[model samples]
Target: MKQKELQIGNLTLRRPIFQGGMGVGVSLGGLAGAVAAAGGAGAISAAQIGFREPDFDTNTVEANLRAMGKELQKARGRAEGGVVGFNIMVAMQHYADYVKQAVKLGADFIVSGAGLPVDLPEYAAGSNVKLAPIVSTEKSAGVILKYWARKFERVPDFLVIEGPKAGGHLGFTGEQLTSFDEAAYGEEVKRIIAKVREYEARFQKKIPVVLGGGISGMEKAARAFALGADAIQAATRFVTTEECDADPRYKQAYLDAREEDILLIKSPVGLPGRAIRNVFADRVMSGERIAPERCRGCIKGCRPTEIPYCITEALIRAVKGDRENGLLFCGADAWKAERIETVQQVVDDLLG
Candidate 1:
C-alpha cells in the first residue's frame, strides 16, 4: 500500500509520521527540527522545557516565553521551513502561559495532553497554529469535543488517540494497563474517529486523527494506518536516535533495557507511568519514597508529603546522565533497540 499525507487543519504532513513529544528536555529543537527536515512532523515537547536554563525555576513568564521563542526559531531554522509544533501538557503548572507563548512564538501547531484541553481553541484563536488534543479513549474525545463545541464553539484541528501501551505518564489506571484489551480499545479508536469525522462534516473541515503510545517499527505503523489512523506518533524509538536531545547515558538505558525491566511504576504526580526498573524504580518499589529538598510544584495534584519521590528531580538526574538515580521512561519495546541509530535511519525504517 502507498503511504498518504496527513492533512491536519490547514497543515499538510508529507509523511504520516509524527515524532511523539517527550517531556523535560528530551524532544526539543535538535530532534524536532531534524524530524521536520526529514519530512515528518516534528513535535517539540514543552514539558519542563525551561529545565535547560540555569535559573529556570525562578525565571519569569516573559523570560520563559523568550526562551521558548528562541528554541522554536532554532528548530525552524534547522527544519528549513518544515512543519514544527509544540506539545504542551494541559496539566503543567502554567498551561495557559505556555500555550500563549507557543502561539506567540509562531508555533505551527500545539498538541496538548495529560488532561483534556477544553479551552484549547480559546487560546489558539486568531493564530495560524493548529490545535490538537491528545486523547486516550472515545469518552475523553467526546468530552473534549462536546465541551469545545458547547463552550468555546470550536473543534480541534486534529486528534491524537494515545493507547495504553504508550510510555511515560499514561492515561490508564495501573491495573487497567496491565490487563488492557486491544480488541476493545481498537473499537474505541474507530468510534473516536467517527466522532471526529462527524465534526469534520459539521465544521466543513477535515480533522486528521493520529495514534500514539507504543507505536514502533514499520509493521506497527502499517497496522495503525490500516486501523484508520491518519498518522502514528512514535516516541520511545526516537529516544535512542542520534538527534534525540537526551544524554548518551539516557539513550544507553533504552538500548540496554530488557523486556522484563520495562515495568509500570507510580509517578509522584499520582499517575502510573512506564519506566525501566532501575535503582530508582527499585527504591520506589521498595517503599522508600523520599521527598526532594526543594519542591518545584510542577504537577497540579502532586503530594510531596505522601509521594515516594520527586519526579522532577529523578527525571533531571536521568537527563543529566545519572543513569542509576535517574528515572528511565521507555515503551514496552524499548528493549528491542540494540544499538544507537540516527534519526534518518529510524524514520526510514518506520516509513519502509
Candidate 2:
C-alpha cells in the first residue's frame, strides 16, 4: 500500500502516523523529535511539561512557560524543522497559558482535548500554528465547531477522533467504553467527517481528520484511512520505543503485561481511564483504605473527599519511575507489546 502524506495547514507530514501525545514528561524531546525526524508528526504532551526543570512545581506561570519553550526548541532542533506540536489538555488548570507558551515556543501545531476547547481560536489568533481538537463523538465535534465558528469565525485546522480504547483519561464511562459497539463508531466517524467537510467547503480549504486511540498496527491504520481518516494517531506503541521519555522500568511494565492486565480503572479526576492493572489499581479496586492529601487542584471538578486517590500524584510517581505506586495509562492492547524497539522501527511497522 502506498503511504499518503497528511497536510495540516502549512505543515506536511510524510507519514500519516502521528505519535499521540502522552503527558507528564512521557513524550518530550527524545521521542517527539525522533518521530518528527522519521517523517511522522511528533507531538509533545504539555501536561506538566515543565516537570524536567528544577523548581518546576513551585515556579510561576511565566517561568514554567519558559521551560516549555526550551524543551520545544530542543525538539525542533532535533527534528531539523520537521512537524512538531504540543498537546494541551483543556481540562488542565492552565490550559490557556500552555497554549500561549506553545505558540511562543514556535510550535508548528497545537492539539487540545479532554474537554471542549471553545476558546482555542481566540488564543490562536495571529499565530501560524495550526489548531486541532480531539473529539470522541460527532456531537462533540459539532459543539466545538459551532463555538469556534460563532466566537472566532475560524474552524479547526484538523480534527482527531479518539475512541474508547485510548489510554490516559478517557472521555467515556467505564460501562460505555466496555460495551460501546465498535461497528457503531464507523458511522460516527463518517458523520464527524461530514461535519468537518461542511466547514472545509465553507472555508474553501481541506481539513484533515485523524483517528486516535487503540490504533497499533498498519492493519488498523489502513482501516481508519479507509473509513475517512487522513491519518492515525498512536500512543502506547511509542511508550516501548527507545526514544520514549518514560523510565525504562515503565516500558518494561508494558512489555511484561498480558491482555488481561489492561483494564478500565476508575480515575480520581472523575473519569474512567484505561490503565495497566498493577498493585495500586488492585488496592483501589479492593476497597482498601486510601486517602487524598493536599489537593493539587489540577482538574476543575475533582472531589477530593469522594475520589479514592489523587491522579496527579499517581501519574507523577509513574513518570518519576515509582512503578508500584503510579497509575500507568495504556491502550486496550498495551499488553500486546512484547519488546522494546526504536522509534523508527515502530513507525516503520505502523507505516508498513
Candidate 3:
C-alpha cells in the first residue's frame, strides 16, 4: 500500500505520521525538527521545557516561556520550514499562556492533551495556527467536539486519539488499561472518527483523525490506517532515533528493554502512566514516597508537599541519562526497539 500525505488544515505533510511529543527534554527541537524535515509533522513537548534554562530553577514560568520560543526557533532552524508545533498539556499550569506563546511564535499548529482542552480555541483565538486536542476514547471525543461547537462555534482542525498503550500520562484509568481490548478500542476509534465527521458535516470542513499508541512499525501503522486514521503518532519509535533529544543512555534503555520491562505506573499528577521498570519506578510501586525537595510548579493544582514525587525532576533525570532514578516513560512497544536509527529511516520504515 502506498503511503498518503496527511493534511491538517492548510498544512500538508508528505507522510501520514506524527512524532508524538515526549516531555522533560525527551523530544525537543532536535527531534521535532528532524521528523518535520523527514516529511512528517514534528511536535515539541512543552512540559517543563526550560529545565535547561539558566533561570529555570528560580523563575519557572518566564524561563519556560523563553525556552519554548528558543526551542521552536531551533526546531524551525532544523525543520527547514516543515510543519513544527508544540504539544502543550492542558493539565499543566498556565496552559493559556503556553498556547498563546506557541501561536505568537508562529507555530504551524498546537496539539493539547493530558486533559480535555475545552478552552483551547479561546486561547488560540485570532490565529491561523491549527488547533487539535488529544483524546483516548469516543466519549471524550464527543464531549470535546460537542462542547467546542456549542461554546466556540468551531471544531478542531484535527484530532489525536491516544490509546491505552501510549506512554507517560495516559487518559485511561488503571482498570481500563488492564481490561483494554484491541478490537473494542478499534471500534472506539471508528466511533471517534464518526463523531469527528458529524462536526465536519455541521461545520462544512474536514477534520483529520490521528491514531497513536503502540504503533511500533509498518504493521501497526497499517492497522491504524485500516481503522480509519488519517495519520499515526509514534513516540517510542522516535525515542530510539538519533535525532531524539534524549540522552544516549535514554535510548539505550529502550533498546535493552524486554517485553516485561515495560509496566503501568502511577504518576503524582493523578494519572496512570506507562514506563520502563526502573529503580525509581520500583520504589514508587513499593509504596515509597519520594518527596520533592523543591517545587518546579509544573502541574496544575499540585501541592508539592502532598504529592508522591516530582515528575519534572524524574523526567529530567531520565532525559539526562540517570536511568536508575529517572522515570523512563515509554510505550508498550518500547521493548521492540533493537537499535538506534535516524528520523528519516524510522519514518520511511513505518510508512512503507
Candidate 4:
C-alpha cells in the first residue's frame, strides 16, 4: 500500500496515524513526541495529567490545569515541528478551559469525546486550533457537526470514527456491543462520512475521517481505509512501543495476556472499558468494592461511593507499574502484541 499524509484543515501530517490519547500519563510527551518525530500526529491525554504533581491529591483541578501547559510545551519541544495535540474529554469540568488553554499554548488540534463536545468550537473560536470529535455512530457525528455548523457556522477539522472494539471507555452500550455487526457498523461509518462531506462541501474545506477501534496493524488500517477512512488512530498498538510512556511492567502485561484474558470492565465514568482481566478486575466483577481516599474529580458524575472504584487511582496504579491490582486498559486485539518495539517500528509496520 502507498502511504499518504493526513491533511486536517490546514495541518498536515506525513503519517496518517493519530496516536490515541491514553490517560493518567500513558501518552504524555515521551510517547506523543516520539510519534510526531516519527511523522505521525501525537496526542497527549489531559485526564489527570497532573497526577505526578505533588499537590495533585489536594488540588486536583488546579494541578491538572497547570500541568497542561508544561506537558504541551514538553511535547512541542520534542515534536520537532511535527503535528501535536491534546485529548480533552467533554465530561471534564470546564472542558472549554482546557480547549482554550491548548489553543493558547499553540496546539495544532484537539480531539474530544467521552461525550459529545458540542461547545468545542465556542472555546476554539477565532483560533487556528483544529477540532476533531471521536464518534461511534452517525447520530453522534451528526449531532456535533450540526450543532457546530448551526452555532459557529463551521465544521470539524477531522472526525475519528471509533468502533466497538476500542479500549478504555467505549461509546457503545453493552447491548450494542453484544449485537455489534461489522457490516452494519461499516455502513454506519459510511453514513457519518457522508455527513462529514456535506459539511466539508458547505465550508469548502476537507474533513478527513480517521477511523479507530481494534485497528491492530497494516491489514486493519487497510480495511478501514477501504471502508472510507482517510486515516487511522491507534492506541493499544502504541502501548507496547518503546517510546510509549507506560511502565515496563505495564507493557509486559500486554505481552503476557491471552485472547481470553481480555474482558469488559465498568468505568466510574459510566462507560464500558476494555481491559485485560487481572486481580483487580476479578475483584470488581465479583462485587468487591474498594474506596478511594480522595476524589480526583476526573469524571463528570463520579461520586466515589456509588461507583465501582476510583478510576483515577486504578489508572494511576497501572501506569506506575502496579499490574496485579491496577486497571489495565487494552484494545480487543492487544493479546496479539508479543514484544516491545519502537514507535518507528509500529508506524512502519502499519504504514509500511
The numbered model that scores best in TM-score is 3
Determine the C-alpha RMSD for candidate 2 after optimal superposition of all C-alphas: 1.6
Model 2 residue runs over 4 Å out of place are 60-63, 303-306
Better of 1 and 3 by lDDT: 3
Cα error, residue 142 of model 2, in Å, equals 0.9
User: Candidate 1's error at 48, in angstroms?
Assistant: 1.3
Clashing pairs in 1: 289-308
Point out the worst 10-residue segment of candidate 2 by lDDT.
55-64
- What is the full ranking by lDDT, best candidate first? 3, 4, 2, 1
Better of 2 and 4 by lDDT: 4
Which is superior by lDDT, 2 or 3? 3
lDDT leader = 3
Candidate 1 has an lDDT of: 0.84
- Misplaced by over 4 Å in model 1 are 60-63
Q: Over the stretch 71-182, how does candidate 4's per-residue lDDT look in tens digits?
A: 8778778887889999999988778778888888888889999999988888888889989999999899999989989998888889988899998889999888868888
lDDT of 3: 0.93
Q: On a 0 to 100 scale, what is the lDDT of residue 316 in model 1?
A: 81
Candidate 3 — which residues are off by over 4 angstroms? none
Return the lDDT, model 3, position 219.
90
Worst 10 residues of 1 by lDDT: 58-67
Clash counts for all predictions: 1, 0, 0, 0
